[model samples]
Target: MLAKTPFIPDKPILIVCGHFGSGKTCVSVALALALKKSGKNVTLVDLDIVNPYFRAADAAELMKANGINCINPEFANTNVDIPSLGAEIHSVFVNAERDPDSVTILDVGGDSGAAALGRYRQMIERAGYNMLFVASKYRPLTDTASAALENLREIEYYSRLRCTHVVNNSNIGDETTQTYVENALDFGRELSELSGLPEAFTSVVKADFCPALAEKYPDKSFFFIDNTTRKLF
Candidate 1:
C-alpha cells in the first residue's frame, strides 16, 4: 500500500515539476495511483510537451486499470513534435472546481516543460493549486543546491506560478541506497532555505528504508515510491 503523505495537497490542483530525470513523472504517477486507491476521483494530466520520452501518457493503461483518468497531449508517444493538447484538458479544471472529491495531478515536463502550463495559469490559480518543485542531486545540472534553485526559478518563471513546496527526490534509480538518501538531506534543507518554501517531503524509492530515516529525521517526512515511469522505455 502507498502511504499518504503531506505532499498530497488539500488543493485540487497539484503540479509536479523538476529537472530532467529528477523523477517528477514517477512521483506524479505514484501520487495519482495513491489518490485513486484512497477513493478519490483522480485525474492525471501529462503536461510534458518538452520531453517526448518517459511521459505519464506511457502509463495510461496502468492508470486506467487503477481507475485514474489520464489526459495526454494530442501528439504524445509519436515522432511528431507538435505541442497541441486536447480540449478535454479544460474539463479537468472545470470538474475539479465543482467536485471537491476530485484532484488533478499535472506531471509537467522537465526544465522548460513547465512553459506548457503557462496558458492554464488563470484556471489553475482560480481553482487553487500546490506546485511542488522536485530536486534531485543525482541529476546533471541540478546536482548542487544553487543549480537546483536556479532550475526551480526557471520553472516558476515559465509557468507564471510560484512553488508552494520543495521535494527532495534525489536518487540513482535502482542504485539508490540509504547512504544516497541520507546524503541528500543537506541538499534538501539548503533548497528549502533558499526557496523559502516548506520541504514537502523526501521521496525514498526503498520502502524499507523509510523507518530508519524517519526515526533519524523526525522533523522531515518521507514518501515511499514505486518506479512506475520505468515502463515508459
Candidate 2:
C-alpha cells in the first residue's frame, strides 16, 4: 500500500463525461464513495441532462446513507425529460474554489451532458477541474481507440474543457465477467495511449475479483464498487 497510489485524485473537482452507455454515472457514484472513504470532504453532482434513464441521482439515498453530498436536478426522479438546473448545482463550483481539501464529482449524461455544462463554463473555468472520460470497448461509438478519440473531441468541444484522464468503466452490469474486465483494461489502456491521457483506473463491481485483477494486470489500479441499486429503466 505504501507504493500504491489510490485512484482518487487530490484535486477538488472531477468531471466524469463519456459517450452514452459508457457507464460514466456508475463510475461517478463509485468515485464519490471512494473519495469520501479516503477521508476527503466529498460531494456528487448529477448533471446528466440528456439521458432520461436512471443516473447518478438515482443513487441519492445510497450516497446520502454513506455520507456523500448528492446534488441532483429538480426533475431527476421524475418522468420528465426536460432538463432542470438548480442553483445548488453551483455549490460544487463554489466549494471547488473555496475548499481545497474537498472533492466534487460531476457525473455528466453523455456528450450532450457535457454540452449542457456549457451553461456553467465560466464557473467551471474559474473553479478549476479535472475531467475524466469514461470509455467502454463494448459500448457503441467507442469500441475502437479511434472512435473513442472522436467522441472525446466532440465532448471537449462542447464542454470547453479538455479531458485530464480516462476511466475504464467497461462493464455490462451483472453480466460482466472477469474475462470482460481483463479485456477492457487492455482496450482502455489502448484508448488512454491514443488519447494521450492517463487512465485513472478500471473498475470491478465485485471485490473478490481484485486478487485476480492484480495477478493478471500487475501494473494497473482498480476500484471495486458493488452497485447498490436495481435499475428501473
Candidate 3:
C-alpha cells in the first residue's frame, strides 16, 4: 500500500470528466478507493447519465462494501430518469460540501451528459471542486492532444467548472505494458503544457505491475487498478 496525501478542504469536489470510452469511471473509482484507504470520508457519486453501460454506479455495491459512500440518483430512486437532476443529488451535494470529512468524487457523463450538470452549476462552483479530465492517448478519436483538449474544454463549459488537472489513463486491455504507461505519462505531460495546466497529478498503472513498478517509480504519482479495488500512491 502507498501513503495517502492530505485532502484539501476547498478541493472537496472532484469532477471526473472525459470523452466517451476514455475510462473516466475507472479513474474516478481508482481515486475514490485510494482516498478511502487514506482514511478520508470519500463519496463516489455517479452522475454519468449519458453512457449507461460504462457507469460508475455499476461498481457502487463494491465501493460501499469497502466503506466508501456511493451516491447515485438511480440508487436512491430507480424510477427517476438518470439524466434528470433530482433532489437526491442536490441533497448529496449540499451535505457533502458541509461535511468536512466528505470527499465527493463525481463521475460525470460524456458529452451528452453535459446538460445535466448545467442544472447544478451553482453547487459545483460553490463547492470549489477540482476537476480532472481523463485523456487516453490510446483511444482512437482522442489520440491527438489537440482533440482531447477541445473535448475537455467542452465538458468544462458544460459543467460550468474549469478543469484543474489532466489524468493520463491510456491502456490496451490486458496487453497494457510498461511502455504503454510511460507513453501515456509523456503524452499527458505534453498535453498539460499545451493546455497551460499543471502537470498531471498522476498516471494509472495496471495492478499486475504495481508490485514491481511501484518500487521502481517511487517518486512519480501512480494509481493502481485490480480485479477487486483501486488505490493510489
Candidate 4:
C-alpha cells in the first residue's frame, strides 16, 4: 500500500514535470495508483517526448491490470522518434469533467520535454490544472535549490502552467535507503523554501528498504511506488 502522502495533488487534473532523470515517471505511476486506491477512476498520460527510457508507457500493462487508463506517444515502446500523442490524450479531460469523480494524471516529459506539451496548453489551461514539478537533488541542474527553481521556471514557461508544488523524488536508483529518504526530506524543505512552493512530499520506492523509514516518519507525507520503471544509471 502507498503512503497517505500530502503531496498527492487533489485536483481532478494534474501534470508531473521534472528535469531529465529526476524520476518523474516513477512518481507519475505511483500517483495514478494512489488516486485509484483512493476510489477515483484515474487516467495517466505519458507525454515523455524527451527520454524514451523510464517512461509511463512502460507501465501500461500493469496500469491496465489495475484499472487505470494510460496514454502515451503514438510511437511509444518503439524505436521511432515520432513525438505525436494519440487523440485519447484529450479525452482524459473530457471524461474527467463528464465523470466528476475521475482524476487525470499527466506525466509530462522532462525539462526539454516540456516543449512537446506546449501544443496542448489551451486545452489544459482553459480547463485549469496544476503541474507538479518533481525535483531530485541527485540530478544535474537540480542539485541545489537555485538550480531547482531555474529548471522549474523553464518547465513552467514551456508548459504554460505554473507549478503549485514540488515533489522531492531524489533517489539513487536501486541503492536507495532509509538514510537517503531522510536526507531527501531536508532537500525537499530547502527547495520548498527557495521556490516558494510547498514541498509536496518525498517519493520513495516501496521496496524492501523503505518500510522502516516510512513507518518512522509518520508526520512527513510520502508517495511510495514500485521503482521498476526507473532508469537506473
TM-scores, in order shown? 0.95, 0.92, 0.85, 0.91
Candidate closer to the true structure by lDDT (higher is better), 2 or 3:
2
Instruction: For candidate 3, give the lDDT of residue 107.
Output: 83
Instruction: Please state the error at residue 18 of candidate 4 in Å.
Output: 0.5
Error at 119, model 2, angstroms? 1.3
Give Cα distance to truth, residue 12, candidate 1, Å. Answer: 1.0
Residue pairs in collision within model 2: none
**Sort by TM-score, top down from the best:** 1, 2, 4, 3
Which candidate wins on TM-score?
A: 1
lDDT of 1 by residue, 1-233 (tens): 57774455789999999997899988898888877877789999999888876788988998999889999999998999898989999998898778999999999988888998899999999999999999999987999889999999999999999999999999998889999999989999999998999998899988888889989989988888888766534
TM-score of 2: 0.92
Instruction: List per-prediction Cα lDDT, in the order shown.
Output: 0.89, 0.81, 0.71, 0.80
Error of 4 at 146 (Å): 1.0
Best by lDDT: 1
Model 3 lDDT per residue over 112-230, tens place: 57656777778878877787788888988778788788888888788777888887778775678987887676677777888887644554446667556557767666666542323
| Lowest-sum lDDT 10-residue window in model 3 | 1-10
Sliding window of 10 residues with minimal summed lDDT for model 4? 1-10
Local accuracy of candidate 2 as per-residue lDDT tens digits, 1-233: 11122476746778889998787877787777777777888898888888886688888888899899988888987878879879998788878878787888888879767887788888877777789998888887788888988999999999888899988877787888898888777788888899999988887766767778878778888777666545655
Could you tell me how far off, in angstroms, the CA of residue 83 lies in candidate 3 after the best superposition? Answer: 2.3
